[model samples]
Target: MNSNYSAQEKNFATALLHNLWKYLLLAASIVATVKIIFFGFDIDE
Candidate 1:
């Protein structure tokens, strides 16, 4: 039972980390887009 619980917890942690990275990247892209649109910041520059 203990081992099973540990495995489940590990899986949950992995999923949470994955989701965090996904959202972080999404937010970064949105911010970059907004900057480009309003401030004329070049992404390549």
Candidate 2:
């Protein structure tokens, strides 16, 4: 029973990390877009 609970907790932690990464990527993309809009598309660096 303890092992089962531990497995569930691990699953939850993995899922949480996955979701956090998803949101981080989304936020990064949004920031990049905003920067492009503000600075123009001259990202030729």
Q: Local error of candidate 2 at 42, Å? A: 10
Writing each residue's lDDT as its tens digit, candidate 2 over 1-45 gives 699999999999999999999999999999999998877756553
Report the C-alpha lDDT of model 1 over 3-22, residue by residue, as the tens digit.
99999999999999999999
| After superposition, candidate 1 runs with Cα above 4 Å error | 41-45
* Count of backbone collisions within predicted model 2: 0
In terms of lDDT, model 1 sits at: 0.91
TM-score of each: 0.76, 0.78
* CA lDDT, every model vs. true structure: 0.91, 0.92
Q: Evaluate residue 11 in candidate 2 and report its C-alpha lDDT on the 0 to 100 scale.
A: 100
User: Model 1 residue 35 lDDT?
Assistant: 82
- RMSD per model, one decimal: 4.5, 4.0
Candidate 2 regions with alpha-carbon error over 4 angstroms: 41-45
